[model samples]
Target: MEEQLQATPICGRHRALNALMAPFGGWDMPIQYEGIIAEHSWCRSSSALFDICHMGEFIFQGDFVADGLEDVFTFSVQTIPLGRSRYGFLLNERGGIVDDLIVFRLAEDKVMIVVNAATAPKDFAVIKERLTGGSFTDITAATGKLDLQGPLSRYVMVEVFGEEVATLPYFRFITLNILGVEAIVSRTGYTGELGYEIFIPADKVGELWDLLLEDERVKPAGLGARDVLRLEVGYSLYGSDIDEETTPLEAGLEGFVNFETTFVGKEALLRQKEQGPPRQKVAFEVNGRRSPRHFYDICSGGENVGMVTSGVFSPMVGKGIGIGFVLPELAVVGTPLTICHERITMEATVCELPFFKDGSVRG
Candidate 1:
């Protein structure tokens, strides 16, 4: 049976704007408003607003060590300073990733966990089960999130929110009063630009959205543009690029896993490390403008050696780019490969991770 998709509080507003709505993560979400290309251009040259309220948020209050939270993730949570956040993974017993999340260190004994929307329920259960003392609470329904991204995002944020928001460094955030409610303004985003992710009360999202759009430099963008922006920067999408069967090492994200600490899958990861990964993650660039979509076969020497997991026609580069898992020998840079679907085949070459090099993420 097909489950009915739920709608967010801003669903009506999105419909009024004639945005394209599609089912994603069990919710009817906006994929685009005016157009994906227009929104993508707007985000690159100016600023774009995104409704990110569907993401999950959790607050944990207890001893980082005693509550078993320190050993929950692959990284050490105690090392993160207040007002700073760190990105890491939550792994299953077999060293496979359950989900990748960001932990914001709010205080010495308090932390906020931001997770992907679709995995919210499962992530909550898994995290709570691992904890022995922390008072953990889910605040997804009570909170709303909006991301303002682009090269000009700082100017718009400084005008509406405050100059303090403009001064926030990367991976850091500050609490501010917005629409008579407390919100977290973080200088972090999925887009490869200078952006801010604002978390406000669920009801106040509309007001904030309207206020930002009032500025000439900002436009409303949807998930379609967001996807392109993230992919260009080589950031991995959860379900597409990684899953429960993919380990961090196999996904080309070994830097995020800290082996000094003991986590659930440490032993498995250690064993795999000694024996090397079976399939290695690879990034490729197509010779033409045609896009290579998901589940496409990657062939080398007339043999199916891998599968493309995420791919797109990069508007910025005017070419197709993709990421996939291939045999170690075929994962070398500049290696020639072929991406094939039902009747579509494209010539591609394995290259570096980021298809787009120039970005304003640090600026």
Candidate 2:
């Protein structure tokens, strides 16, 4: 049997609200406070707050080029301006992704890396071993993160956080006083909506949560709704869609990898680029409301072709949609496929990503 999971500081609050609790990455996190669809709709129509404290954070203070940090990720860290962040991946020698992360250039000599919870420890170890200069520290325990997402997220944030947040452009962050502690508000989120991710001191996180809940326009959402939102937008979940065994090129994330710089996985990526990828990532939409799920088989012409990595019943599209890896030839748009599982199968068609195209993500 699996060991009992630990709970967050807001576990009592979630329990008081009758939230559905489940173990995720060793934490007893709230799956849903109300219903998944209801919370998802609320986020799309109004504003929703998400407790993202389960994610991990790290701080590295050193020369970007000399400390070997510049070449650690797929993107160049030295070119990133202070108070701005860029998303990329850390890869193994074989070009397989170790972890997908966002690096915030706090200063010329300081940077912060935000990574997924499930890959946190492995990411730390891999990053540290590759460093040749500067000191690195895991600041996850000292940091807490929250995401407020939706079309109305901007208005709601300006009302609660401050007017300064209104000026933040995409991928930019500003340090502000929140709950009597310095917090960083970044115009970034997983959901393809206008959103902000607030990073505050851990001790003050609960207070910030309560204050946000006090707003009539804001409702507390959970990971269940978050999953649906991200899937609908075609954003890849770290462990589910990409893993250590998966290369970014095959995962449909080659844009994040920069070959102009020297990195650990450059040689392998160059080789893969010269020789076509073995498999390619593809997105599809179901014909009906029945949703595909992880590990579901993708079949074409009565033959198994691929495997679903992440899927959900899309609230925005009012249909089922999924992303999976399949043979390169079968990844064309309009290709008919079948999603198969134990005693169940559904008809689907290969389609473009972002099942819901009408979003305020850039606005």
Candidate 3:
């Protein structure tokens, strides 16, 4: 039997705008509006709004250390200062990533854990089971999220939400009243641009969305554009670039892990660190405009070494770029590779991350 796809608070708005809808992470989501490339370009040059309510949110209001919340993620939640957010992975017993998530320290004893939509159920169960005590509640149904991203997003935000959001540093947040309700505005985003994530009540989301789009500066962007924008900055997509079977070490995300603190996957990661990972993540650029695709073989010396997990023709870079797993020896920059699938083959080279570096992410 086919599963019923869920709808976000902005579903009607998306359909009214004639967006291309598709099932993503169990939700009926907009894949693109006018077009993928057009939306992507818009986000690079101006402000782009995204419906992020499909993602999950949870509230953890209790002791960070005594309640066992500190040991839940790769990073320590107790160390995060109030009004700041931190990104890290939730790992399993074998050091494999359960999910890549962000923890927002709303107060001394309260946090909001945001996770990818597909892994929310599993992540919630895992986290609850690991905790010895704490009041952890799934707040996904009650919350709505919208991401406004681009170089011009800050100006648009200030004009609409007031000047209080103007001085928010990256990874920091401020609670502000909007439309008669408190909304958490965080200076963080998936797009490699200056952006803000607004979390409001589900009932008020449509009003907020309408309010944002009323300004000519903001246009609605979809998941398709979102994927390309993230890839240009080398952000890993949960199901594609990393998963429960992929560890942070092999995914090139070990820096987010704190070995000083004990977590569920600490011991296994320690062993892997000592032994070195057998395979490593590699970022590569295609020599031409041909795009590599997921599950395409990555070859070296005429032998299959690994497979491409995420790949797309990058308009900003004017070429194809991809991230794949390869034998550790071939993960070095400047190494030549061939991406092959059936009759399609393209030449690629292991390159550094951030395929497009001139972003307004810090501006």
Candidate 4:
């Protein structure tokens, strides 16, 4: 039997636009409207709106120390200042990443956790089991999330929301009024651009979506463009780049893992830190515009060394960019590599992250 797919509150709006719809993370989502490349290009220069309400949201209110909330993730939750959000991993006992999530410090005793759609149930279960005491509840069904991303995102957000959004600062959030409801607006996004993520009641999502589209500068972009945008910046995709079998150390996300803070998988991570991760994530660029896709073989010295995880032909870079795990020695920048799948093969070179660097993310 086929599984039922969930729909966001803005699903009708997407259908009305005659968007190309498909299943993504167990939800019926729009893959594109005008087109993938066009939307991707628009987001790079202007702004693109994404319906992200399918993501999971959880509310936890309790003592950070006494309730074991402080040690649940790779980062220290108790130390996150109010109005700020911290990104980190939820790991398993073997030091593998269960999910990469963000914890928003909503109040002194309350925090909101945002997680990927497909991994939400498992992430919530692991968090609940790890905690000895806390008022934790899933709020995904009642909450809605929209990501307005790109160079012009900040300007659009300020114009629609208010002047308070103008200086929200990266990683910080402000509670503001929108459509007669309280919404949490955060200066954070996955596109490696200056952007905002708006969290509001599920019922009001369509109104906000419509309201934002009223601006000629804002257009709806689907998952296809989102994938391209994220890959161009070398951001890791949850299931594709990092999963329960991949650790943060191997994924080049050690900076997010606080060694000073003891948490689940700390011992294993310590062991790997001393012994070194057997394989490391590498960012590479193809010699031309031919795209490398997921599961493509990464070759070196006439042997398959790794497999492509997240990949795409980036319009911004005018070439194919991809991230994959390879032998530690082959992860070095400037190393020559070959990406192959079936009859297609392309020469590539190990490169540093953020394949496109001129983004207005800091602006």
RMSD for each of the candidates: 0.9, 1.0, 0.6, 0.7
lDDT per model, in order?
0.92, 0.91, 0.95, 0.95
Clashes of each: 0, 0, 0, 0
lDDT of 2 by residue, 1-363 (tens): 987676666778889999999988878899999899999998888889998888889999988898899889999999999899999999999999999999998888999999998788899999999999899999888888989998899998898888998889999998998767899999999888889999999888889889888888889999999999999989999889998888999988999988888899899989998998999999999999999999999999899999999998897898999999999999899999999998999999999988999877888
Clashing pairs in model 1, backbone N/Cα/C closer than 3 A: none
For residues 1-363, write the lDDT of model 3, one tens digit per residue: 898999998899999999999999999999999999999999999999999999999999999999999999999999999999999999999999999999999988999999999999999999999888879999998999999999999999998899999999999999999999999999999989999999999999999999999989999999999999999989999999999888999999999999888799999999999999989999999999998888999999999999999999999999999999999999999999999999998999999999989889889
Q: Which tens-of-lDDT digit does each residue in 1-363 have in candidate 1?
A: 988887777888899999999988778889999999899889989999998888899999999999999999999998999999999999999999999999999999999999998899999999999999979999998888999999999999999988888678999999999889998999999989889999898899889988998999999998998998888888999999998999999999999999998798888899989999899999999999999888999998889999999898999979999999999888899999999988899999999968888788898
Give the per-residue lDDT of model 4 (tens digit) for 212-330. 99999999999999999989888899999999999999999999999999899999999999999999999999999999999999999889999999889989899999999999999
Looking at model 3, how many pairs of residues clash?
0
Clashing pairs in 2: none
**Candidate 2 lDDT score relative to the true structure:** 0.91
Question: In candidate 1, where is summed lDDT lowest over 10 consecutive residues?
Answer: 2-11
Misplaced by over 4 Å in model 3 are none
Task: Sort the predicted structures by TM-score, highest score first.
Answer: 3, 4, 1, 2
